[model samples]
Every structure is written in C-alpha cells, then in structure tokens.
Target: MSDRDPQPVERQLPTEEARDLLALVRDIAQREIAPKAAEEEDAGRFPREIFTLLSEAGLLGLPYDSEYGGGDQPYEVYLQVLEELAAARLTVGLGVSVHTLASYALATYGTKQQQVEHLPAMLGGGLLGAYCLSEPSSGSDAASLRTKAVRDAEGSWVIDGTKAWITHGGIADFYTVMARTGEDGPRGITAFLVPGDAPGLSGAAPEKKMGMKGSPTAQVHFDGVRVPDDRRIGEEGQGFSIALAALDSGRLGIAACAIGLAQAALDEAVRYATQRRQFGRAIADFQGLRFMLADMATQIEAGRALYLAAARLRDAGRPFAKQAAMAKLHCTDAAMKVTTDAVQILGGYGYTADFPAERYMREAKVLQIVEGTNQIQRMVIARHLAGPEGR
Candidate 1:
C-alpha cells in the first residue's frame, strides 16, 4: 500500500446526518476495512464479522424504512455509502450490495405482516441474505429458469432445482428465491423468502472465480425445500416483475461499486507515478503519464455523475430504469478501462500482486459481467429507445 493516505472524496450530501454518515463510513472503512483488505482477499477469507459490524452500525439497511430497523435513507445516500465501502474493499462493498438486493423482494412486495416478521432481523439484526434467480441453464435468459416451487396440500411450497452464482450462498441467513410456479416463462415464476436453514436447502462449493474470491459465489440447491405460504414475497406469478425491479436498483449498486473500484485503482496509480522516478525525475512529471491520469479521472467523475443522477431519479419516484441501465453500462465499462490503465501506468509492478492495481483490474472485470452484462445493459437501453426486438 502507498504510504500516502488517499484523499477523501468531496461529496454533496443533502443533509447534516448524511454527511455524518459518510464520515463514519470512511472512518470504519479506513480503520477497519482498508487495513486488512489486501491480506484477507489474498487469503480468500470472507470477513463475516465486518458485515456484522456494518449491521451494528446501521449501515446495512440505509435505503429501507426505519419502521423495521432500516436507516430510511434515500438511494442517493445509500449508494454513496456503497461507493465508499467498495473503495475500501470490493468484497465488502459488493457483498453489501448483494445483501441489499436480496432484501428487495420482501421489503418492497411482501405484506405488512411479512415485513414485520422478517424485515427487522434482515435489516439490522446481523442477518445476511442471498438472492436466488439465475440457474445453471439460465443466466442472461433468466425468464427460462427451471427451478420449480410446487404448492403442497397444506399450502406450503416445495422448491426444487438449483440456483447458480449466488453471492452469499451457503452463509446467508436467508435467501430471496425466484422459482417457477405457473407457466414456462416469466409469468409462471413466484418469489419466496426461505430461511437459510430451511430443510433440504444446500449450497454447492463456491466457484473458483477470477476475482472477488473472498466473496463466495456458489450454487444453491433446493431439494424439495419447504417454505410457508406466508413467506411468498408477492402475488403468485409476479416474481419476474419483482426480480426486474430489483435489478434496476441493483444495477445502480453495481455502478457505484465499479466506480469505487476504479477510484481505488486511480489512487494507487497516482501514488505510484509520483513516487517512482525515472531519469532523475518522477514519471508522473512526464506529459504522457499526466494526460493518462487526467483521462482516468475524467472517466471516473463522469461515471459517478451518471450513477448519482439515476439514483436521484429513483429517490424521486420517477422512471429510472433506462438511466440505471445506462449507468451500469458506462460505469462498469469505465472501471474496466480505468483499472486497466492504472495497471499500464504501474507497468511491471501493476502486473504483480505486490500492488493493488492488478487486484483492482481483476475485480473490475466482474463488474462488467454482474447485475447485468454490458451487452444486456445495451439491450435494455435499446429496448427503452426503439422498443423490444420482435421474434
């Protein structure tokens, strides 16, 4: 790590409380998260305790209602918090984003009784969550997921099939799952909140991923996993719509994370460039390197503005899906570009794990692929523009 402390980002928070919240997040991130990030991630160790600490600090539920232990903050504030956490460590930041995504179905669609029963523990009671949507056979084509949830004579549901690429997988306290309940396509699906310890539910080994290895990505299997009817998150056959809505918001979370990762890479590059001298002068003094840094910073700033604009739209209850898709597309692509540029700036050292540029590069690649692939984001944008492609 560079000896120089990274400068704090200047934020335009809406209120004194939000400003204080960001300060607290930076403190926790620096003192607690940043210190061990490189070591733990290198060891492929998941920091479960850090998430518990975040829960204790009320950072886990910022965008939810306070009535059920949430912080009641808007998406703008919540996503900024995500950006700070991600800048400290991608695992923590992305883990928090995935946890929030997992909570969305129930928080937004469940009955008041369901919310009262589950939201408190989920939001601030130290419990973690996973979202179950993608199956081995269905990733980008999620509407074709084969997982089935059959209603028994007792009205309880029996879920069967497997979910692939689950972020928190085996370790989550609960899973917000989508499974087929009616027809063969999107409309046939239903959502359920299954307890982590639900009978017959199990997780396969975590995938050996290229990056974000510390955050487990595993396949979750349901072998007739039973859940009470009350756990159903929305009206029957509404799961696809719920999942899409959650993705629209979730994509913004990813955009924030991508920018955070890019920012970290930029900070690392600047530190290296100024410290490493060539021909009796710092390479950063070279006009070529200076311009590279300038472009990287500009991209990062543009990505940040794009995601924040989408976030504000969400907070205003306006149509923001297209904007969210655009942000996800641009920000992740920018992260990939910026981090790769950082590695280029660092040259040989950047290619090695001795510095974080390589790690940032590796982590940034996944952002382009997660939440929704850049290709999918483009399709979503195009659909919004010219209408969906007809078969």
Candidate 2:
C-alpha cells in the first residue's frame, strides 16, 4: 500500500528453516546439477540420479501433506527451492513442476485408498508422473480435447486416443490422463491414473524440442487402455475442474521457474560485465549498462512478488485463479525479456553455449508456451474480471 512496498506481495523473506532448505538446495544445485546440465541437455538425457538425490534430500515432494512422505513445506518455500533448481538446470525444474501438477488430481480428488497407494511412490521418489490433458487438436481449448474413455461391461474404463506434447511422456512411471466420458464439453471429461506398463498404453518417440532438451517430451497413445472405475479421479464430470484447479497451482510453479531462469541470466550478465572489460574498465562500471541490470533485477523482483502473492492467496483458500493467471502471464513475459537482455549484456559470449544465458533464453521461450500459453493466461484473467457471462 505504500510507495516503497507493494500491496499483494507474495513472498516472505526466507525464514531460518527456509534459508537452511535453500542453502541445502543451492549446494546441491551448484555442485551436482550445474556441471551436468549443458552436457545432458545437449544429449537429450534425463538425469535419473539427480532426481534420486533430490528425493533423498526430501525435496521431491515439498508441498504436500507430511503424512504422505512429503516435506509438507509451504508454496513460498517450495517455489524458492524450485528457483534454485532451475537456476542450475531448467530441465529438472520443469520436470518437478510437471510432477507437482500431476499430483494435484490425486491429492485433491482421489479417494484415501488411491492416495495411500500412489502418494508413497511419488513422494518417495521411485516413480515419476506425467499429466495428459493436451491433445494434438486441443492445447488452449482444453474442453475441445478429443480423447475418450468409455465404460465397459466389466466395470472398467477403456480409453483410446493420443495426448500430445506430454512432458515426461515416455519416461514417466505413471500418467494422469483426462478423457471425455460424456457429452462434448469439459463437463463430460474424467481423469484417470494409468500406470506406465498398462497394456495398450505407449508413447511415441520423443519430440525434438527447441530447448529443455534434457527433458523428454512426446505424444502418449492410449489404445484401448483399461482401468478400474476406482482409478477415476473425482466424479465423472469433475476432470475439467480438477485440471483447471491443478493448473492454477501449476502456473505458480512455472512462474517460479521463470524467476529462477531470469535470476540465472542476470547473475551471468553481472559476472560477465565485471570480467569482460571495455574501454579499460569493467563494463558494469558503465552507468548505461548498470541501469539495464537494475531494470532486469527490478523486473525479476516484481515477478517474484506477483507469483508469491497469488500463491499465498491459494494457500489461504481464497479465490486465486485470476491472480495465478496474471502471475503466469506477467512473470513469464518478464523472464523472456530479462533472459534476452541477459544475453545482450554478455554481448558475443551470450550467443554461445559456452555460457548459460543462451540456454536460459531458449528455456524462457517454452515457459511462455507451456502450462497454458501467456495468451491463454490473459484470456483466463480477462474472463475472471469480466464475470462468467462476459460483456
């Protein structure tokens, strides 16, 4: 509400416990993750060992209830951990975000039996998860998704269709799939938990993506894949709502990734400016370049504030869909701008893989596209403001 401090701020300064957690994560990130990121990404490799390290450190399940073997940490804490991970490597950050999104359906909608059966593996770190909501024909328009699941005489659900652009597609141990079960609308959709080894369930070869190369992306094909009715999440008509609700939280995760990427870019820029001298002085000493760094830092701080505010709202059980969408849109845009500027600050070296900024720039592009494009985020926010029946 004051000039120096903004209203609706999201993050609390790192608490003692949070600071300890951050230190632990940072140590692992810089020492363990940073060295391998570039090589793994270049080879399109997924780091199974790194995930094991994170799980052993109690990081894989940071935000869920503790009874399920999670850290039971706050989003505020969880997101900062994510930021550090991403600063080290975007692929890991994105994979964690996707896993968290996949967890939402089971945590929020599944029965107690289901939770007990699934959460331990997910929280304990043996199994990875994939979220299957988007299809070849439907990305932003989720309600128009074509995948279908029909009930059989044996009281099982038979699913047949392809899910496109699935993160962890071929690599995941399980998938959270949404399929149409009723009339042609979101209300007709239902969610199911499908194990990776299920018969007739398979994935296409991974997509050759522009960035986040270490993170596998592919199309999942469910050809008459069957599951018991108990596998369905929530009631028959609740999948769309569940997916959107999960996305409200997922958007914040992406926002954290953006902040981490931007911070990495800024750090590289600052380091480069100091080391790469111009006119017989460190370039950072130049007021023009200094101002640009100031702007980049300011934007990143603002993005952090926005996403954290929305996260606090969600944790407090308040209406946060609009705020989450706004955070996703603004923070991702700011990250894209900041990372690009980071490259510019590094001048020629920024364009090469020798430094991390070039990769950060490429990684930022996907943040804009995934978890609902910034364009779709704008529409979500606009709809929230304009009311259910818009003018």
Candidate 3:
C-alpha cells in the first residue's frame, strides 16, 4: 500500500488556469507536504518553511484580490486548493485557512491605504496571521466576550483581554482581533489589526490537544496592547458583522478541509483493504469492508459537493451563510464518521500510531468544534430556517 499512490480527485474546475493551479498544488502536496506530515505531526513540529513555500507560490492568498498580492481566484478554486493541501496534512491546510480568516477583515473592510500598506506583505510576503475571536470564557458565545479595547487620550486603542483557541497564537505575524469597544453585547465589539510583537502582547503555552498539535493553539493575551486608529479594520460596533462574514467564508474552508481529510482516510483504508489478506483472501474481497469504503467515499463526495455549492454561491456574490453553516456541519460530521470507519477497517493497527488512521480520526474531531461548534452551526441553520429563536 505504501508503494502505491492515492488516486487524484476528479475536479470540475471552471477554467483551464484553475486546472493548472490544481496540478501545481497537487505536485507540491505530493512532493513537499504529504511526505513529512505524519512525522512532523507526531513530533508536534510546525512546518513554517512549507508556509513560506506556499506564500512564495501565491497559494496563501488565492481568494483575495490580486492587485494587493492575492491570487484573485474565486472561492471555488481557492477551496479546492485547500482540500488538496489538507489531504496532505491538516496542519498545513488548517493553517492556511486560519491565515485567510485572519486576513479577511482587513481585505474586506480596511481602507485602501491599509490594504496597500499591509495586504501585500500578509498575502505573499512570508508573513503568517491569526484570527482572534474566541475567548477563554466565551467560545460558542463569542458575542459575550469580555475583551476590552478602549480609546485613550492619544487616540490609540488599548486592548486588554485574552483570546483563546487562536490557531497561530504566538507564532503569527499579525492578529485580527475582535474586542469589546462599547456596549456589553455584540454591538460593542470592534475589530483591530494588531501586530504580533506589539508591546504587552503575549501568548501562553500551546494547548496540549487530542489532535493537530503541530498547529499551535494558544491563549493570546492583550495587556493594554495598543494600536493606532488606522489599524481598525471597520467602523466601531461593526466588528461582529465583519467576524460573521469572515466566519461564513471560513466555514467553507473548514468544510473543504474536512472532505479532504475524509478522502485521505478513505484512500488509506482502500489501500490497506486491497493489500491485507485475511481468510485466504484480500480484505477488499469482503462485502462488508467494500460497503464501508463505498459509504465513506459517498459521504466525502457529498461533502465536497456541498462545500463547492456554497463556494459557488459566494463567488456569485449571493447570500450563502445558511449554506455555509450546513456544509460545515455536514462535512465535519462526515469526516468524523469516515475517519472512525477507516480506523475500524484497519482493525487493531488503526488504534495505534503505526498507522495514519488514528491521526485522521483525532484530527477530524476538532473540525466539528472549530469555526463554530456543530451545535452552533445547527443554531445558525435553524435561525435561517425558523427565523431568530424567540428570546
């Protein structure tokens, strides 16, 4: 099984350029990312150099405008790239997704001057970014965050709070931070582009996690970290809106990554089944195992379709938040189920670190909880369906 390559996905790309882009991505994934994934992940080592390679290749900012160092690809193409990267390694794929999320507020809401000043360096200049919204006390209830950003006499904002579950945390070059600047609820929140090395900014130790340890998840502290007015991405009290918009796009990235991870697991399971002999026959000859593989593949395909549909809606500049939530929920759930089945198919070998199946299973679990928990996704979908819940 180790000697054979996994089959490439048959993608329906809109343009020849996109096909070329996918080919480039596949080559890089096969040559650079996939080979080192399991070992680096097992060692809990972040592949900062691979991200530099991606930045150089213009993969980091594919969905944003090309004028300011972005690739200008639509979400459809951008997400497929993410899926390919994720199939190679969740750490790299999810890192790219979080970086994109961190860049969204500035690209979408910042002034032309801001974009001209920072976007180029962020997008393709070997810089990494982190998104800061989830707080230690408020994960699901992000609107109820206690982080405070106060305007001082110097006209600079002094931020004071701790943001939890930040993907890049201490390692990021910049942070897109959402802090309370006014009232007690969502209305008071404001977004700021804070430099990672700003005075009083620090990160606690990375969380020891069930999976994806190679991607640092840490608590970022803002102890009176100050930023100039120019660093504010959008209007005060408009931060939550920016956050929601970014999350809608970010959820699609997660959905794509989930499908990619599922696809990888399915490929591994198939490869093992075809090679491993049992009862004087290959395991692939067993109907039960074949059915499991079929089910896993179907779910992955469905998830890919769902995420791409959401991406297309986004590319058309249409309303897609509900669809985004749905894709995230379904794809992540599919990832968990598919990874678990892959582990089951591998039998005892899947339970140990000797195989990638266990790692895939561990990684799939966190997807259901991030971006927004699956519970929050259901609520978001329900709100779109039944209107806002009676409070």
Q: Each candidate: what lDDT?
A: 0.95, 0.87, 0.96
Candidate 3 residue 49 C-alpha distance from true site, Å: 0.3
lDDT of model 3, residue 248: 98
For model 1, give the 10-residue run with minimal summed lDDT: 1-10
lDDT of 2 by residue, 1-391 (tens): 0122112223364578877788898899989998899988988899978887888888888899888878878887888888889878988887888988988899889999989988888877667889999999999999999999999999999999999999999778889999999999889999999999999999999999888989989999999999999899999989999999999999999999899888878877877787777799888899999999999999999998898888788767889889989988988999999999989988888899888888899989999999899988888887877865435
TM-score quality measure for candidate 2: 0.95
Residue 9, model 3: lDDT of 95
Ranking by lDDT: 3, 1, 2
Q: CA shift at 57, candidate 2, in angstroms? A: 1.9
Q: Is candidate 1 or candidate 2 better by lDDT?
A: 1
In terms of TM-score, how similar is model 3 to the real structure?
0.99
lDDT of 3 by residue, 176-237 (tens): 99999999988999999999999999999999999998999999999989899999989999
Native RMSD of candidate 3 (Å) = 0.8
